[model samples]
Target: MKPILLLFIFVSTLFATQYSVIISKKVDVGTLSAQQVRDIFLQKRHSLGNQKIIPLNLVGQEPSRIAFETDVLGMGRDRLNTYWIKQHFQGITPPITQPSHESIKAFVQNVEGAIGYIPSSMVDNSVKVLYEF
Candidate 1:
């Protein structure tokens, strides 16, 4: 019974959700490698050719944010926090944050260079998906 229960939980977790990295439709980027996406979010690479990239983040400790940091940024919470702290003194800062996925979509829709991550279900014709995982 315990084995069956554990299997059920694991399967549910695997299929429960998906994530997407999105950008404004007007930005004109075709596709981005994971490295490029990571660079943009880390503020390591500020632009994609002629387009100025603006990374938007969800507010602290949000599950989607954690997934993004883990899957995309490849950093755990503590390490990422340490990174941002160091960047702060170097005149670099983390991305702008929105409280909810709805706000992320709205900002990306209205702002030309904006990019953010959100649950794949919330996506619509308003934004272009750059990457998904």
Candidate 2:
């Protein structure tokens, strides 16, 4: 390979963060479309077939959250905030939150029906990736 190509690849790899939606190995969900994942996170739809779905979220101004919101949920922070506020009045609320990707993975691994997103590179045998962004 050419040196320029090699350098470009290295730089991109260093800066880029690939994110994915993941679930506990125990959850029986199949691959989900972006829309389905968005619904789950937004609390608009719950359960996939027989299994109940519990979505996890990263807290406040997180880069992973920003990317996931933009790429998958197709909403900005302001829009999401307004949405949740309206839902709140009707007794609906946002998903549970964890502080970091490591916490998210651990939560998914141990909690049945638990699902969340994190950096794609953080995934391991403990969790099943349902969608990527």
Candidate 3:
């Protein structure tokens, strides 16, 4: 294999494995099914149990934001933009959006019924990882 190709593969693999989302430690919810988590993130439904659900997102230009939309939300950029635009025209805004992972973490920690995604390594005792994938 070409050295340059191998180097590209190595760097991509390394970063890909390094991101994840976390929640408060007190959050008793176990590993959530992917679909349920998706629902919450999309605001398709509320309440992940008795706990009302509030989803948060990273800033618009962030790579992690793209990953969450494509990898987790399974929506392409165009489609998501259209969805949000329609929601706006309908007088409904999407979930709270933060400018960075750090802001997302702080918001999730401070707000009840809040859930957000960040790098996997960022997981700490202050938050629980509802899912990783």
Candidate 4:
């Protein structure tokens, strides 16, 4: 590859935003493993025992969403689309989507068992961070 292309890659990676998985402060569940997060986001697992979990997604093309999907869920866009399509046939639906980090934080803060991810910088004490990446 060209030197300029390599430099661009390095710069882009250096500046990439970090993300965190957050849950409502009211949720009793503590830290979660990556597989647990993946299951929740993919709708393969619903609740942590009696407490139901509602996973939230960002609307449209958000960088955090892409990072969460790639790093946490370990799936590409096309694969995720196909997975959701197959899930639809099995009566499973995708996670609810919020327009922005603010909205996701608000929803998680207010809802009982809500869990969502946002840019690490956007997190405050209003919600509990389950994981960071």
lDDT of 2 by residue, 1-133 (tens): 6999999999997889999899988877789999999999999888988888889999998998999988899999999999999999999989999998899889888888889998888888889999998
lDDT per model, in order? 0.91, 0.91, 0.80, 0.91
Clashes of 1: 0
> lDDT tens string, model 4, 1-133?
7999999999998887888999988778888899999999999899987999899999877888888889999999999999999999999999999999999999998998999998888988888989888
Question: Model 1 — which ten-residue stretch has the worst lDDT?
Answer: 25-34
Query: TM per model?
Result: 0.90, 0.88, 0.84, 0.88
Q: What CA RMSD would you report for each candidate?
A: 2.1, 3.5, 2.4, 2.4
Model 3 steric clash pairs: 19-120, 20-118, 20-119, 20-120, 23-127, 23-128
Off by over 4 Å in 3: 1-11, 89-91
| lDDT measured at residue 43 in model 3 versus the true structure, 0 to 100 | 70
Question: Candidate 3: lDDT over CA atoms?
Answer: 0.80
**Model 1 misplaced stretches (Cα beyond 4 Å):** 1-10
- Whose TM-score is higher: candidate 1's or candidate 2's? 1
Worst 10 residues of 3 by lDDT: 17-26
The residue-by-residue lDDT of candidate 1 on 17-87, one tens digit each, is 89889999888888788899999999999987898888999998998999899988999999999999999
Better of 2 and 3 by TM-score: 2
Candidate 1 structure lDDT:
0.91
What is the TM-score of candidate 2? 0.88
Write down the TM-score for model 3: 0.84
